[model samples]
Target: MVNKLVFLILSTVILVGNQSFAQKKITLKEAFKDKFLIGVAVNRSQINQSNQEETKLITSQFNALTAENDMKWMYIHPKEDTFNFEQADKLVELAKANDMFVVGHTLVWHSQLAPWVFKTDKGDTINNAELTSRLKKHISTIVEKYKGKIDAWDVVNEALAEDGSYRKSPFYTIGGESFIENAFRFAHTADPEAELYYNDYNLINAEKRDGAIRIINNLKSKNIKIDGVGIQAHWSLEEPTIEEIETAIKMYSETGVKVMFTELDISVLPSPWNSPTADVSVSFENNPTMNPYPNGLPDSVQTQLAKRYAAIFELFNKHADKIGRVTFWGLHDGLSWKNNFPIRGRTDYTLLFDRAMEPKKAFNAVIDTVND
Candidate 1:
């Protein structure tokens, strides 16, 4: 009788162990398979598969990929006549091999642009006609090369000011608002099947959100193929309440285009400025207080991070239909731009994954939102 009992107990333990293993196997991609794609912005190292562990983690957890900087105007077309496809090509091939959706980061932007794009050999500003021609050539060349492979393009990035006016960028100065329209038109002409998006940060603010809508409506009214709006959700622990985010999502979707949470990361550090901003040019001197938690994040702070993520994901789940994709800015905390952005040499725990590539409390929290 005792022997029989032992055999039954052993069988029960084996079955329970298998069930536990299965539960742990559920990944971010698997959890949101029906709702939307789970994507991560990857750098050159990740795309080249140089780090085996990171590559494995990326393939296992995510179903979509965005080249963090490779496909940008400055890197892809550095010189006026020279086009470099070495890294960008590798990224596309990597995405294809993994069967992941590919997002072309950006075609036109005020920042990170090649110098020659707006200047002559004698350091003179180019005319509107020359600028427009250069813009068309740049957009057409990149879009046509990976026409079918790239699923979407962030055609114009950060073109709107905070007060619902056009950012006086060189593009705007040269071509006015027609630059945006021409960009979308050029992209569509190159690849009619690809989706085009206007990406900007701080879009949750009422005025900026309205500005984005104006751009969307303007494109639609002109019959331009603007398909989505990418909100660069570079949020922090205590700013931009859940209601604000949800409202922005609803309002953007009401414009008849999908809303994407692109470049998503929640910083767990103190902001130097009073208001939230993601302007890359802004910087401050780092103090010891600013760089707190350098050794590691405390359990209490980690819990806050986890709960904050949980609430954000719950909101994302509630509006899944309107959200096309949710892409984390980087794969791991160490790779996050938050560590140095706005303040240099400050260690910030912003991403879902920790520095060691292990899923942190925030990652589990995000996954649990769907699992529950």
Candidate 2:
């Protein structure tokens, strides 16, 4: 009788916790409504409304949504002459329907590009002149299509490497250091009112932070428009001390540009490399040491996750004036890119919601910080 009674109580508690998050009157978007936008990156399933619960979470909790892949160059502009708007249109339509802010991610990227992006229509090597023309056309077309809709554009992304060096992407190789300047110029020409950001990860590293600073300042000096800096906070629990994040935010804000915590997620698994890069391409084979906690997140790890998110949100609240947006890379643990990233088939609990779509302690902790 005691065992059955205890079982009933435990079951009731689980049911209550799961329902409470969605049942609550307020949302993350509503909590931070006046301060800055709360956002999440959306996959196609979410945009298509196939993932109904995720869609509900997005509509309820977030005021902004950036596409996880649709807006990227290859996906939207696959062929040399074929600029596909089907997938991207769905995202914009959903955002508009939900009254959410839209951030058009990635006008240019080193990865995930069709060969036509780097080659001419006639299969010729894209010279500097050809590349510049292509850039102008591509930027103009995309920015114009979603001009009044997408609130911001990641005008350029991950253009710098670690150790403060410019990444030798095809753009840089062909257009020289001047490519970034010209890209921003093209984007501004297409949509003068929409905000433009230079987005990248690992800004907490001093060298990378300073490099981003130099890039933004140089744009401003040249009279090119740069509105914000995106720190893709694809972080771990322990590394990047709060001091470093705060310092980076303060530094970026000093550039007279809004600071954004873009692609924010805290990975609990052991990293394959010690000092990780922002590169999403880096991956390794799964092993027990790296894939610990595959079955489920331990309670201790869950607490640490809560504490970590709370601290970061506290810092964000402290500097709310300088921040423009804070976007999680994904909506929930089951959908997080961290799971397949750096090792496919590795289970990862790197988001505020668990695989069951229930809010973790981290979600409640963030809400408490805002309320406090």
Which residue ranges in model 1 land beyond 4 Å of their true spot? 1-23
lDDT of 1: 0.92
lDDT of 1 by residue, 258-300 (tens): 9999999999999998767889989999999888888999999
* Local distance difference test values of all predictions, in order: 0.92, 0.89
TM-score of 1: 0.94
Q: List runs of model 2 lying over 4 Å from the truth.
A: 1-25, 121-124
Which residue pairs in model 1 clash with each other?
Answer: none
Model 1 C-alpha RMSD vs. true structure (Å) is: 2.7
